[model samples]
Target: MDKNIVFLLNFKINKASSSRKRGSRLIQNLDSRLRGNDKRVKVKKRKKFVLLSLVFNYILFVIYRLSYAAKYLIN
Candidate 1:
């Protein structure tokens, strides 16, 4: 009877550990997939920000040139 109890306990422990390993593997896969998507989104956002900044700078430069021309005219 004692041997049977020992065998049952061992089996239960092994089963529980295998399930835990599977769970951890699933989580790892999900995390990697999310990270891949996040990187793509970050790259797209960075490109948009660079384009916007360039446009904004061009507008500012045009305004400055216009103001300079006006000053010259007034003088």
Candidate 2:
């Protein structure tokens, strides 16, 4: 009877350990996915910022060129 009890306890312990390992693996996978998504969002935002700045700079350059031409024509 004692031997049977010991065997049952060992089995239970092994099953519990395996379940914990599986849970940890699931958590790690979710964390990695979230990190990847965050990186993508940051990259997209940076690209958008760069494009907007480029467009703003181009507009400023055109305005400056137009003013210069107007001054030359008036003179």
Clashes of each: 0, 0
lDDT of 1 by residue, 1-75 (tens): 368755755565565566887656555554555456655677899999999999999999999999999999999
Runs off by more than 4 Å, candidate 1:
1-37
**Candidate 2 displacement at residue 48 in angstroms:** 0.3
Q: By summed lDDT, which 10 consecutive residues of candidate 2 come out lowest?
A: 26-35
Model 2: per-residue lDDT, tens digit, 1-75? 368755755565565566887656555554555456655677899999999999999999999999999999999
Give per-residue lDDT, candidate 2, residue 30: 45
C-alpha lDDT (0 to 100) for residue 6 of candidate 1: 56
